[model samples]
Target: MTDASIPSDGKWIPQAMSVKYLAKAKTALRAVASGEKVDWDTSGEKTVPVEVFDEDGQRVFTAEITMNVKLN
Candidate 1:
């Protein structure tokens, strides 16, 4: 049986050169969703409130990145 290849963990790349950027930093429906264009700065920081959920669907983490160095 051939083993399926998993996706990458994510690495920095040029914003224009990039085709997509996954926003898996949140889980709540009211939080960041897929295919959502967020505002970022030169430091590549997007000010968004995130709420993470556990395996049991319980809110676990709430992160507010002071400086998210994700330069597309």
Candidate 2:
């Protein structure tokens, strides 16, 4: 991931980016879901909030990204 700044406001935002960036994001997600070790640059945070969206452009759920994320 690049040095993109996450918005401080708690709002769901969509970002426009290159296909390469999308691919990289997907790879990172896949790695995390597939039990691969992920080193998150949280800057000393314990958990990060991640919202998952569905195909209908709706948020299905939110996840807490942490070091002890259950692999699998």
Best by lDDT: 1
In the range 1-72, model 2's lDDT, one tens digit per residue, is: 212232232222223321112111222222112212333332332343455444444444445443321211
Query: Scored by CA lDDT, what does every candidate get?
Result: 0.35, 0.31
Tell me the lDDT of model 2 at 32.
19
Model 1 deviation from the true structure expressed as Cα RMSD, one decimal place: 12.7
lDDT (Cα, tens digit) per residue for candidate 1, span 1-72: 001111233223322211122344354333332213343323443343455554456555554432233433
Off by over 4 Å in 2: 1-45, 68-72
Taking the candidates one at a time, how many backbone clashes does each contain? Answer: 2, 0
RMSD of each: 12.7, 13.8
TM-score of each: 0.31, 0.31
Query: lDDT at 60 for candidate 1?
Result: 55
* Poorest lDDT segment (10 consecutive residues) of candidate 1: 1-10
